[model samples]
Target: MSAPDLLDYSRRWPLRLVLASVGLFLYLPLLVLVAMSFNDSRQTTVWRGFTLDWYARLGGNLELLAALGNSLAIAALATLLSLLLGTLAAIALWRFRFPGLGLVSAAFALPIVVPEICMGVAMLIFFARILPWPAGLPWPLSLGPIVIAHVAFIFPFVAVIVRARLESFNRETEEAARDLGAGPWRALLDVVVPHLKPSLVAGALLAFTLSLDDFVITFFTAGPDTVTFPVKVYSMVRFGVTPEVNAVSTVLLVLTVALTALALRVQALAGEKLAP
Candidate 1:
């Protein structure tokens, strides 16, 4: 081999080693968790052989199942609301100029920039002060406050993703639709939205995942009756880690991986469609 080619090959080894090290750092714990989920032993650290007892037990855990259901319901509702509001906000920010536009944009982003614990405290205080419900109300923690808090934080992320997509979008298509006698709403629905479908989907998925995985904000805003899956997991782990916790973590890991793969597939197809 040529001298230059040999030097280039030598340079690539460090990059490969670094990437492998990073990949192991990130995924090794996940692999261990998955392995432990199937362990027959009650002890988390010891490997007593493989079994499906934990997975079987998960089916009978009514409280855990209920928490999971609550999580799914809240995430779905939050994602729907976030998508609607975020899309509108992104469009307005992208297409219009207004007084205090900068301020509005900054306000939209405060949730993302602020510490989650701070946001949680603020939401708790705000809801306690403003909610019309009396103190005597049974099950004071309803789905409403949790969903609202989730949307407050998740929508900002959605707006930012959609805005980034909008930055690369062409405005001429909407103008052409308008020229053909379409109204603003019609043009937006027919032209702009189709073009933004990928980003919208991506943003919605992100919002849903964040809502599902969030602990701090959910913990503060959630009521006794509104326990989510993550909160349930935290409650479990407070005692000590177990095979059941490993099972739950494995399930969540699989779910997140599946969703991430789906997002990548959708983005790839969208890119192909946009290709000239």
Candidate 2:
């Protein structure tokens, strides 16, 4: 409507440019990896020709298949555990304000703020030292330890996400249910849970993604038999890069992107309904 207004709009072009640059910076490597995965050459940079040999090779690779299965198992378990614990913790914190409430919340969030390496190493030490070594640890390691570490790190994310959802939630609904003779458990199940379901799902997805992609903690805690995909990828990367790695990464990328989109769609729908 005005020259100054037009100028302000024109200046916003820089923000778009910056966002484009950032996106390219983040995704360009993934593009290269995806492209290279089709290369027939041993050299990553020099692509001789395109072929699906890598994917075919990956199909028959038992070790890779096993690692993928293990990763899925761990991620699923960690996500479920984190969602349950984090949702309960968030509810307790939100519904009741008591002594050390803030402290408890902070403790839950500590894993997110602390450095990953520090957390991973500390967890490894705790499991190996603070806890007694069994007469013999099965597999020389157990998925249990890895799952515990993942839950510790991932629960904070779930709690933070779910707490945000709870912040804007109306407690009056729960109170109304309680006034109607519904007990606390019934009120939660019938009233609070419906409102919180979207956030809980989002939190679970986040936990699953974090656990699936985790390397540092898994590296430290996973024993010889408990190799997850990220750890397997790391091991493969140590020797050299392979097209199979790219294929695996691409599969993971697709799964994560699909899940993220689904979660966002659910959140959008939930928000629309929840809005006044």
Best candidate per lDDT, number? 1
lDDT for residue 198 in candidate 1, whole number 0-100: 83
Computed on alpha carbons, the lDDT of every model, listed in order, comes to 0.87, 0.85
Candidates' TM-scores? 0.90, 0.88
After superposition, the stretches of candidate 2 with alpha carbons farther than 4 Å from their true spots are 1-20, 132-141
State the lDDT at 155 in candidate 1.
Answer: 92
Candidate 1 residue runs with Cα over 4 Å from true position = 1-11, 132-141
> Each model's number of backbone clashes?
0, 0
Residue-by-residue lDDT tens digits, candidate 1, 1-276: 788977775368788799889999998998988998998888647888879999999988899988998899899999999999999999999889999999999999998989999989887887778773334343323577888999998998999999988887788988999999999999989988887888888898889889998999999887777789999999999987767788878888898889899888988988897895
